[model samples]
Target: MSFKVWMMEIRVPYLLLPIILSIVGGALALYHGSFDVVNFFLFMAVLLLLHITVNTLNDYYDHKTGIDFHTKRTMFNGGTGILQKGLLEPQQVYRAAMGCFIIAAVIGAYVVYRVGLILLPLLILGMIFALFYTQIFARNMLGEISAGLGLGVLPIIGAFMVHGLPLTIDCVILSVAAGILTFNLLLLNEFPDVDADVPGGRRNIVISLGTKKAAKLYSLLTFSVYGILLIFTLMGVLPPLCLIGLATLPIAFKAASLSFTEPNVGDSFFQGQKANVQMILVTQLFVAVGIVASLLLI
Candidate 1:
């Protein structure tokens, strides 16, 4: 397959999550006065590969199961349209996904050698999630949970620990905020796919809760992201500057409002999805920057 085709298969825009997650994790490390440049880069490399594996493997499985064919594709939720368009063979995508998983494992091994076995569990969990997410987890109600833990909470915590910093309450609080944001990301994206997913035997949040209830849940969790940050900051669990993450609240509120008022297939829905994405990225980024700023100011 051409490199362009491969990039499309892997869904490059989603790769930004890994980069931002890495920064959040690394920033947590920096906040605690531990900075290891080598370990940080290694951690980032692993995040990127794991993200690619998730994208490619999900595409491969979705194509095989006819999910992609039925899915109403969107910039936010649907699998990359590469395989359905016959741009890449399913086997090619699967093999590439496996290749990424293997490479990420090897790098994770080296990091484990240097850091300790503490990270091995997260690495294994991430690989499992990447492989089984589409085939198994999404079919059950566990898809959102798996995505949040495997991609969000676990990776951020692993990023923090890779710098040889001990996990603390502050690190965990930040990781949970990341996880909730991720959970909302996957949950909201599922809105457009409910009809497609039911035929595919998927039982994700939107499908199980129905769209309106799920929309309320999404709005609740979206607000909770900032709620947790605010509560923790006031309780002295997080730095005061972490409140900077709330700067994205307007975008988040707009997204939530649209979720309640707009149909899932309309332009407003797409706008809401875009706003959610913007909020997710910038909130995490602002929190990370706040951590660094706190460190510098201290």
Candidate 2:
């Protein structure tokens, strides 16, 4: 294959964006005096590799199960790539995924060596959750709960590993905010795949609840994060500036309204997915800013 063809097959550019964001988030954590630059980058690198592996494995499994072939399925924004377009074979994708996972495992092993055996159980749980999420078993109903625990609690554990201490209530609150934002993103992103998934026996949360009910749930969770942040701030568990995440509320509410109003609308899925990605990105930005502001002003 020509270099251009191989490049197209890999979709490396699309994959890099999320890795970049992960690195930026880790950098921000370091800026907030959470850890040294080296440890933060190492953690980010491991996370980025793990995420990519999961994405690739998901595509491989979806193809194997015929879920990628359904007619009504619209690709989730910048989707898992290989299965969405047949640019790569399923076995090839699986092999590539395994390569990424091996890399992640090496990094994770280093972390465990440095941080003690506590990292072992969390890593095992995270890997199990990722493996079962849409593969061997369906945990779609427990999506939010899984996301909260994995993204929120696990990251804090990673952070503590780097810092060599337990996380404070403030750090835990920030981690919860990250988890809620991640969960909401996943929930809304599933909207577009509802039709395709339902026929393919891929009963995701949106399909389980029906789109209308799912939209309501999505909205409730999005707004509830902000509400919880405010409460945390008032209770002195989190810094007041954490409410900076509220700036994204109007956009979220608008997206929620559209999702609710036009549940089966052809374009609603894509629209809602776009809005969810935006919400996730914006929330990350605001969270970083909020942490900085809190450190300086509060």
Candidate 3:
């Protein structure tokens, strides 16, 4: 396949979400132990493959459902334009997704052997969610939570686990924050597709709850992320330097406020979609940076 076709099919840009999550995991690990560059990159490859699997499979499923056909898509909210344009056959997309999944599984198995079975739950959960997401979770108001936990929380925990140490309170606490940021990522992005998703049989949180309530839920979830960080910092669970995460509050607020104030869906909420994506990515980036900064200070 050509580079553009691969990029469009795999939705490579969205890989940023998993990339940042891996950073959050690796950085939090550094606070307790020395960095393992080889192990870190190995896990990164596994993550990228899993991310590719999900993106490809999601597009295949969405295309089959005709949702991608009817949706007014933007850069961030739509299925990768690959299938919609007939750039690749549906079977090609499905096969590619399976190929990515097998590669990630082999790598994950290797990591499990090297590290222990501690990562098994995360590995299993991530795969299950990736495979079934478009068919089941996307219809059960679970797309947002699944995205957060799979892309956000599990990666952080898995990142920390590969170092072969027992998980720390700080690791768990930080992972939750990372997960919440990821949840917001999908939560806000869903608004633009609610119309298409509803008709396509996707009962995503936005479609199931109505954008207004989903918007409020977005606010609550976004606010809770910072709230967790601040509380943990005050309790001495997180490093003082991690307060740097709070530096992102203004942008996050703008994202949350846009979700509720703008109140539209199916492409009309494009600005809100942008704000929400910014909030999700920027907040997690800062949180990971905060963890790494503490390591640097020492």
Candidate 4:
């Protein structure tokens, strides 16, 4: 296949957004003199690569498990552009996913070399979790917990690798807060996919809790993230202005209310997917703004 064909099949451009956001977050943390620039950049690169690899793998597996078949017609969003669109064979998609994972492993190995053997196990576990998230095993049972640990704790490990031991409690708190925010994003995204996911045997939290309860869970997590920030500020850990994240509360509340009233109201999978994506992007923007404000004001 031509390069353009492959790119189109994988939706590679859309993948850049998350990679860029992650790099921005990591860079912002470093800009505040949190760690060595070189090491921080390397860590960011590793994460961005891993995230892209996971996205690719998800596309491949969603197709492998027949999730993409009905996605084209129903209220289900399709991934693995190749499989969904019939541009590439299943084996080809699988091979491409493995290639991305291999590249991520190389980057991870370097991180281990720079840090210590302690991070190796975490790295291996993370890779496995990434693969199994939508692949061979549906650990969707532990989705929230895994999301928190993988997104929150793992990034903090990356930060510490560059900064070294005797880690700052402040960073840890920020990391946990960031992780919670990330987890909520994932949770919200799953809302629209509940229908297709249930039939496909992908029963995640949304499937287990049902749409109404899951919507409430999303709302609770959204508010709780800012609430935790406020509490931290009261305790003098986070800056008071970090509560600027509350600025996005109106948007979040609107999304939550809509989600609760019409959990799966979109006309099609694409529309539903768009709604969930909007929530996640808006929340991330608020969190990013909050992070910047905290760094400056605190």
Candidate 5:
């Protein structure tokens, strides 16, 4: 496969999540006065590889189940359509997914070795989520929670742990906000996939609650992320500078407003998805920036 095909296969645009997630965790560690540049890079490598594994395995399983064949491929929802396009064999994608997981595990093991055994369970859980997310969790109601935990909460905690720091109260609070933000992202994206998901044996939040309620839930959770940040910042649990994350609120409101309307594969819904993505990335990026800026101001 050529470079572009490979990038498409792994959903390269979505890869930004792991990078931002790594920084969130790493910056929190830095704020606590425990940071190693080498370990931070290793943590990012593991996150990037595991994220690629999630993408490839999702495409492989979705293709095998014919979900990709039935769903409308969009910039956000649906798989990459690589398998359906005959660009890559299913087994090839499967192998690539497994390859990335094995490499991530090796690096994670090294992280554990350097950081102490505290990180072992989280590393193992991350591997499990990568391997079984599309096959198991998406079919049950656990998919959104799994995404929030694996992609959201745990990365921040693990990144903090790599600095040999114990779990602090502030870090846990910030991590939950990350998880909720990610939960909203997955919930919003599921709107267009409800029809295909029902027949595909998937029972995610949108499938369980119906799109109307799910969209409401999406909007509620999206704003609640800022609410959490604001409450904690005011309580002095988070740096007051973390309120910079709320700067994305206008974009978030537009995204949430659009979610209430029909969210089919139309231009309006696409804009909503695009806005949601921007909100997720920019909010997390600003939060990390705020934490680091607090350190400098001190």
Candidate 6:
């Protein structure tokens, strides 16, 4: 397969979310005085690989189940568009996904060996989420939960555990922010896929809760995440410097408004959709920056 096509199907840009999450994890570890440069590299390697694995497998399954065929393909919602265009055969994509999964598994084994048995459940949960998310989890509400855990809580916990950091209230609060933001990432992005996904037996929050209700839920959850962060900061659980993350609220507020007023990603509402796509990235990066800054300045 072509490197260009492979990278496109892998959705390299989307992978940045996971990287940001891992950075938050690493930042949390640093806050606890447990950051290790070597462990950080290893943790990132597994995280990046697992993320690519999920993307590849999701593309393969979507194509196999005919979801991609009916999808109104967008840059964000539809499957990578590579399979639908015939750039790569189904078998090729499947094999690529499996190969990446094998590599991730190897690194996961290394992580388990290094971090001890406490991390085994997280590793296993991640594998299940990557492999069966579209087939099984997407149909139920489990999909978003899996995404939140895989993309959020697990990474921070794994990163912290690798450094042998003791869990603390501040750490849990930071990890909760990661989970909430990541959950919203999937929640907003799913709006465009409601039609295609439904036929494929996927019922995301957008479909189950209805667009209007989901929109309200999205707004509430967005504010709730920031509220919790602010509460912790004010209570002295998080460093006072972490209040800088609140600066992301304007962007998030826009995203919430877009979700409420324009829930679709068609040409008419594309700009709103753009805000939806960026909300998680901006919020998570700002939070990670605040956490890391607290590490250095506190």
The best candidate by TM-score is 5
**RMSD of each predicted structure:** 1.1, 3.3, 1.8, 3.5, 0.9, 1.7
Cα lDDT of all candidates, in order? 0.88, 0.63, 0.81, 0.62, 0.90, 0.80
Tens-place lDDT per residue, model 6, 157-213, is 777777877667777777777788778778877877788888888878888998789
Query: Residue 212 of model 4: what lDDT?
Result: 81
The global Cα lDDT (0 to 1) of model 2 is 0.63
List model 4 lDDT by residue over 231-267, tens digit each: 8867976545556656666666666666565544554
Comparison by TM-score, 2 against 3, better one = 3
Q: All candidates' TM-scores?
A: 0.97, 0.84, 0.94, 0.81, 0.98, 0.94
lDDT of 1: 0.88
lDDT of 2 by residue, 110-150 (tens): 87787678777767766665555566444346755565565
Better of 1 and 6 by lDDT: 1
lDDT (C-alpha) at residue 201 in model 5: 83
Model 6 misses residue 156 by how many Å? 1.5
Estimate, for each residue in 205-249, the C-alpha lDDT of model 3 and write its tens digit: 777788789888989988998899899988989876778878878
| Model 5 misplacement above 4 A | none
The TM-score of candidate 2 is 0.84
lDDT of 1 by residue, 129-240 (tens): 8778888898889999999998889988999999998889988998899999999999989888777788878888888788899999999999999999999999988977
lDDT tens digits, residue span 49-94, model 5: 9999999999898898888898887989888999999998899999
Pairwise lDDT winner, candidates 4 and 6: 6
